[model samples]
Target: MTDGAPPRARSARLCTLARCVALAVALAGCAGTGPGTAPRPSPAPRTTSPQELCTRLVTHWAHRLLADADGGYGDYQSMGLSNGQYEILRTVLDAGRAEERINGAVSAKELIGHQIARSCTERYRGGGPTGGPWQ
Candidate 1:
């Protein structure tokens, strides 16, 4: 009931008032800028270790060379390999080939992986090459 309105009009006014209150509450919630509503900090960037990078490079080139039936070493400079990495690749491939002959292709692939890991770790143990950038 209202002072000058009929019962139906009073109900309509109450409904509109309720709708306004609900809208204001919803907007207030969206406008919040408290600590809990702050944007989350981005995650730290991931970094690859030198040894891991070396292993990846050598392993990728080794697989490429092994897959090519022509048995070409290709241009190491064009392959993005450092001098040291190229040497590592050559050594690993030699062993890989011997392993393939003795065991199987699968054994050779496994040996390549192990050798790359070991070689890269050893190469980077002293904080990578100090001779030059391409070493």
Candidate 2:
């Protein structure tokens, strides 16, 4: 209580306390907020998904099979298909061969789209698989 203190002295003391409180508040706010909003790190570059990779593989093999028709019968294991995927690939190649026979190689490539999608989608719908990464 200022009791009988000089008004000017009391006013100065109050002003000093207000300033100190303001400074403390400002510093506290900064500490609570930590660094000002930092630029978020750039997102990882987009890459092909497994389904897309499957499409690419099946289509590539379909083309290769279409081209040679005989001499290109390499193992599908080397071509990066799982056992289930290899079955689909074989079916796709068979379809592609028929497509090539009927509509020509250009049109044969179109057959790869849905078959691989269906197979891969079913293959992955079970959720994150256990025994393999890309399987």
Candidate 3:
């Protein structure tokens, strides 16, 4: 339906309509919540168990220490390992070394993994150290 309007007038009307539509869309988003609306609750954070944490730490350091015989990673405290974890590492490494000599590096690495998992599980079986905090 032409209203005998000039092209400029038609274009201006279209522009105004577009602006109104945009404003309506923008306002619709903000209409979801009012002043009385309560905020959504966030999800609770997940926590790692002591056994799992010990397993990860021991596994990481065991691999590194096994690869480098020069003790390049520093002491137990520097490596973020407790005394108990360090003892586990030493025990695993000794077995790992023997395995490496007889079977190979691959076999020794596999043994390290198994030993670390088993030892860590046993260590945290009673909900972690009983002797002291450092244990």
Candidate 4:
């Protein structure tokens, strides 16, 4: 099957085909690999509600903010906010009185944020919540 093509050109074509096949095989191997090396792990089957997850994240960040003075509450505000994080913060901060009283059909996100803020306030208010007389 030589249509006036030089030997060098034919060799180059063979090389290109070989390279393409090798690449295809490599990609196929990657596809068979288990989750260990998958491009993306299937998102954890959401056993809990979004509110729950958001709340947990907010609480965690808030605690971190209070503990890490260099970070501060501002950090909590943006910690894990994907897009709509304001609602969580507003609800948590304004819904209840004291950090402990944050309740009543509260979203998980709200509870988490409230807890964090409460912790910080409690620590700052003086001798450690309830005036336990500093340690």
Candidate 5:
């Protein structure tokens, strides 16, 4: 064995390196938003009209709906919403237009839900009361 302990140490190092490489590949594969899928399209230019702003705010909430944990947009039939409604909500939230429209009147839930359900008029249709308008 000459002056050294042994050759087993080299094999251990090789095994560790292989494990690291395999782990890295597995993680990269799990990341669905990995490279080459195309970056998300830029949001629409800011609007100057008040109505447009309000509508945008509503659209933001609708998109945050929790149809499934996996983030699938639901068909209006079972979910009681149309594709337009789902698209609007997702668009508004993605655009980050709510910070401008919401005020002291909005609650965390209300604001968030409104932002999420902005376009889910059918699923969460009817605006009667939400426990004193977020107060």
Candidate 6:
């Protein structure tokens, strides 16, 4: 009999050891990119005029709030509005409600168009109140 371990046992141990070493080496080559690694940013949403933004967001939110008798107001953050922007929206919506009552939804929509452009122009006249590219 061989002085060392049996041939099959020795081969099995060597094979397992080799596989473990190969796996370790393979894993070592792959370092996961976690924090501190700047990942490619996703494409940003297409920007439009402040008036356009107001037009889009205000109409949507107005409908939502009006749909519920509770006037379930949504947060500005959810509506993608800043505090200043929301104030403008509130004023616009208030006027729109009056317009709608007197005329109809059509008149209200026209009012929104005019108010959004005027309000946004005023709100953003001072170079949009910030230097960020969001403007």
- Over 1-135, each residue of candidate 6 has an lDDT whose tens digit, in order, gives 565998899889989999999999988766455567766688999878665666577667766664456765668888887777777778877888888889987887778768877877776666554544433
Candidate ordering by lDDT (highest first): 1, 3, 6, 2, 4, 5
Clashing pairs in 3: none
User: Whole-model Cα lDDT per candidate?
Assistant: 0.90, 0.71, 0.90, 0.51, 0.48, 0.73
Show model 3 residue runs off by greater than 4 Å: 1-41
Summarize candidate 4's per-residue lDDT along 41-60 as a digit string, tens digits: 78778485444555555565
Q: After superposition, how far is residue 120 of candidate 2 from its true place, in Å?
A: 2.1
- Residue pairs with colliding backbones in model 1 are none
Over 12-83, each residue of candidate 5 has an lDDT whose tens digit, in order, gives 777899999999999987676676776568899974443343344444334444222354554544544345
How many clashes show up in model 5? 13
List the candidate 4 regions with Cα displacement exceeding 4 Å.
Answer: 1-46, 72-78, 86-135
Better of 1 and 5 by lDDT: 1
Compared with the true structure, the alpha-carbon lDDT of candidate 4 equals 0.51
Whole-model alpha-carbon lDDT for candidate 3: 0.90
Model 6 pairs whose backbones collide: none
- Shift in Å, residue 90, candidate 4: 7.9
